[model samples]
Target: MNFVCDRVAVTDAVGIVQKAVASRSTLPVLEGILIKASEGRVVLTGNDLEIGIECVIAADVSAPGKVVVNSNLFGTAVRKMTGDTITVKMLPNNAVSIKCGNSEIKLNGINAEEFPEIPKFETEFDIVLSQREFKSLIRHTIFAVGTNEAKLILTGCLLEASGNNVNMVAVDGFRLALKKVVTEESSVSGYFGDVSLVIPAKTLRELNNIIVDRDDKIIIKCSQKNVRFEFDNVVFTSRLLEGDFIEYKKIIPTEFKTKITADLKSLIEAVDRASIIITNEINKSPLIMKISGGEIRILCETGAGAVDEVVPVEMTGADIEIGFNNKYLLEALKAAEGDRVNLDFIGPINPCLITPYEGDDFKFIVLPVRLRTDVSMDV
Candidate 1:
């Protein structure tokens, strides 16, 4: 393959596809990126069986050919090169030469025929949404996905579509995050139906990074087996996990005994500071939150020391004291966009539901830690 392209465009495409390249795979071809140059465009693809990414760059193509080159080496060399243009040419000895400015590097290349072919969906149900909206939804929920391999389904995010709305949910047994947005149109022809598919969190995160700044609308096409995301010059495909997502709504409490509103920045900083001291203990010490009389106090203690912060809040219902992992709380709080956030606690042991005071679309449920009474206590 021979093509000349902008360094920035090639670098971005390489970085994105590299995310899907297998780091340690028995199949050597899976570790390399497949480059297809034809019809005045260059296509880059990387796949590790579960997830695959394809990116197209507008290039001046002199020859039509395809080759697979080591993704890591290619990405590193391209990034280090100083030039506005990158020229890649396939040689007769099954090797590829990358030339930029005064530097030229020759790398061993594999036959494109040996690369695994990614499946293409024939019949697809499509949904349309802006890049920012889709990216935000993934970021808000992907962090809560389970990482355990044993629970394969939990490691993926649930994508459900009904009528004109799409919802994404992720949980790791201990916590759950659900985010939804309404769209004006959907090409999915059904009776306001919902398709529940578990998409790997890693794929979702990678997709988010690639489409972060893309303002154009994205087309999400899905079959029963794989999900495809297509935009300007990129296409992402991920294998769907075959399993029923736990009925997450059943676990979310409908009501709460106490609801408190506090500044998101203040709460995040307090929890972060408390976590520093709490990590010293054996049991992974938890942060305690006591809400009473228009004030909320957060406390945590360990072998090193303890920290306490009091922040004023607008609260109602009975007073409640709760314990939770400071890290979990901080993550949920980081998703809070507004200055004030509302926390709903049913009891000291039950999961706490957090949301922005005026927004009802995003919800975060964090399971509380078992309160330890041995610590120095203050009400």
Candidate 2:
């Protein structure tokens, strides 16, 4: 394999594909990046069985061949190289030579045939949406994906489609986040009705980094077992979780006993301040919210200190007090959009539901933490 490519362009492409390179694997091939040189371009691919990322960049290819090299060594070497162009050549015995300006390095390479083949989908169904919209869908709900491996299904976010409307939902055991958007157009052709998929959070996070906030369209192709995302000379594919996702509709509360409307930024600031006292002792300190008299008072007591804060709000239904894990409440509030947000409470013990004050585009539910008897709520 012999290829000469722009230093910056190849470095960026290498970084992009390296996200899928296995950090720790028994098979050495899984930790290597495959480089394929063709007529006028070079393709780099990294796959770790669960997810695979491929990037193509323009290059001058003197010889058409392929080689696999350690992703970590190649990425670091390419990034640190000094010059406008980089030349790569595969020598005898699978040894690879890399040269950029005055720097030169010979990296041991694996035969390209050893790399695992990325699955090719037969394109059963597909959906189209702008990169901005797709990124928003992932960022809005990815925080709520469960980390517990026992319930493997909860580790991924659910993507459900009906007509042109799409809903992305993520739920941990303690909280749930839902984002709704309308696609430019909808396609669920191979299926009888709606199409649902559970996509792993790790894959979505990497994809979010790859897709920029642009109006350019992105194509999502789905098959029986794998899903592929094609955008900007890059293809990202991942296997869908096999089990059924939780029934999210049943989990969201329909009726509420209390409703409070507050400025989103102000509420976040208040909670953030309350969290400071218990930042080191999160398990022992619970942020307390006392809702009454058209005002929401925040209180927290911990081994370090205590915090008493007040933020005005518009309230109706009934006055209530609730306790919550500081981190969970803050994360939901940070993810919420719009200048103001509405909080609907079923009671002090039930989950607190949060939504935008104006639109029904998003909903977040955070379960309340049970306050310990020793902690006093004085505000």
Candidate 3:
């Protein structure tokens, strides 16, 4: 491959594709980035057998060819190149030469033929949504995706589409998070009436990073087996997890014994402070919430000491006390949107449901932790 591309373009392309380069792999080809130059455009591709990313960069290609270069080395060289533009030329013996300004570097390139072929889809795009909306859904629920590999399906976020509405749901057995949004239009048509996909959290996180400006649009195409995301000049493909996601609808509590509305920022701050000393203990202690007299008091006791903070809240129905794993609560709070959030409690032992005070677009549920014997509650 021989191409003259802007230094910034090369650097960005390498950076984008490197996200898919396998960090530890038995196959060396999976550790390299494929560079294809043809018809005045240069394409970069990387695949680790799970997810693959390919993007095109505008370049002047005097010679059309393809080469596989070490992702780590090529990425570093592109970033450290000392010129506004760089020329990449594939030498005769599978060696590659990079020239930038007065600097010269040569590296052995892998044979492109050895790289695994990334999956390709033939169907038309099934769903179209704004990049901002797609990103919002991911950020809201990705944290709840189960990291436990044994529970296979829970390791991914469930993506479902019906008519013009799209929903992303994730759970880690201990907690559940749901983010729903309606697109301006959708072309989702299938035999099941609705399309469902379980996309791994790792893929969604990378997709989130690539969707740059909010104004951009994303075209999503999915089959029974794989899904494709096309945006900008990049195409992303991932294998879908097999099997149905847990019947999550039955998991959300429909009724509450007590509902408390509190300032989102204030509640987060109080919980964060209360959790400061509750770390790495064998007890795996929880932060306590006592709701009474229109106020919520957060307290935590640990080997270090105790923290107690009170934040005013608007409460109705009944007063309640609850226990929750501080880490899970903090993650959900950080992912939640808006200035005010509502917490619904059925009882001290039931899951605590959290949602925006004004809308149902986002909902989070964290199962309560056991109230430790050493801690006393005023309930």
What does the lDDT come to for candidate 3?
0.89
Give the winner by TM-score: 1 or 3.
3
Q: How does each model score on TM-score? A: 0.92, 0.94, 0.95
Can you tell me which runs of candidate 2 are displaced by over 4 Å? Answer: 187-192, 279-282, 372-379
Per-residue CA lDDT of model 3 for 68-145, tens digit only, reads 988999889879987899999999877789999988889898888888889876753377788998999899999999
Alpha-carbon lDDT of model 1:
0.86
Ranking by lDDT: 2, 3, 1
- The parts of candidate 3 lying over 4 Å away from their true place are 187-192, 373-379
In model 2, pairs of residues that clash are none
Sort the candidates on TM-score, descending order: 3, 2, 1
Q: Which whole-number lDDT from 0 to 100 does residue 22 have in model 1?
A: 94
Per-residue error for 342 in candidate 2, Å, reads 0.6
Superposition TM-score, candidate 3 onto the true structure: 0.95
Worst 10 residues of 1 by lDDT: 187-196
lDDT of each residue in 213-237, candidate 2, tens digit only:
9988888899868999999989999
